[model samples]
Target: MSDANGGFRPRLRALDRRQGLAFMAALAERLRPNYLLYAEASEQGDPAALRVIHDLIWEALLVKEARIDFERQAEKLAEMEPPAEDESFGARRALEAVMALAACLDSLRGEAPEAALEVSELSRSGVQAFIELTEGEEDAQRLAALIRQHPLMDDEYDFQAAVLEAVEAPLDRGALKELRRLGRNGGVSNLGLTLD
Candidate 1:
């Protein structure tokens, strides 16, 4: 279920640097499958590269001394964004995944303090777009209401809440690993896309 104000932005805003990075990493892990499917279909981007970036983010979270070249990683991630002209729903979802990862990288670089909040909004927007595309609802008012009640959207809201709750605690390697698994959501995305 969605909050009336949209999402847990306030809670995300309160997170410390490490907690914020953890939050972004988990949500990006959940959305990675969307990019994987798109890359497989279009043969344009490298899913492996994206996976490497995600792994780096997780490592930074779990290992205090983990060294990552955030600038280079961000450059690589920029290459993954689908062309703006590609208006297909899959492309949109793929872009969301890429952008979410970008936000994670930005957080790691200490560039965007609100990266977690940005990822939260991206996750919810991806769900809303999926609902719009699949349900074929044209009216703005109806679509807004439908998004609130839709199971997929509910899953998104619930998943974000869970991730936020999980990241609030002190995290170690094991805890971060568990958070990654939880974000995977049993291999399904907010858009219900599965990794092949």
Candidate 2:
């Protein structure tokens, strides 16, 4: 379907339906930024102190959808620990962290409307990449590479893919487990915000 502007809309994939929670979690991680932006230059404060207020404004106005997604992931993971094979326990925890990043993004977005607009444009474009997955491996790889190149870091897709692959086929259990854990902390898990 096309939007009012005639831009092509994305249809959610079968994979998205089967792993909606995972998709949202991945998105939240993707839209959220890494490291706080400097609030202001200050000699009174340490030359280097982590301040995320700038990033907060970027998230709220820009990555609201992804933030909402991350919040859901975090909420869902609150109760369980060490999930069973089907439960994806490790992925759940990583989703929680994605929520944290979204929270920070929301805060940043409130402060800077212009920057927020730019970020939102990037996010909408990113979703188009998600839509491209239905085409084929070439499309998927292109999207994945685009995602990897994106300023926001989140490795959930890579992690989830590895897990899914292992679940679907025979893979090294140890390697699979490691990838699952790494997915949570990996570069892709930066929670949807640009490092810059």
The TM-score of predicted model 2 comes to: 0.24
After superposing candidate 1 on the true structure, give the runs of residues whose Cα lies further than 4 Å from its correct spot.
1-7
Error of 1 at 186 (Å): 1.7
TM-scores of all predicted structures: 0.93, 0.24
TM-score of 1: 0.93
Give the per-residue Cα lDDT of candidate 2 at 158: 38
lDDT per residue (tens digit) for residues 44-78 in model 2: 11112111322332233333353444344323333
Count of clashes in candidate 1: 0
Clashing pairs in 1: none
lDDT of 1: 0.85
lDDT over C-alpha atoms for residue 22 of model 2: 27
Candidate that scores best on lDDT: 1
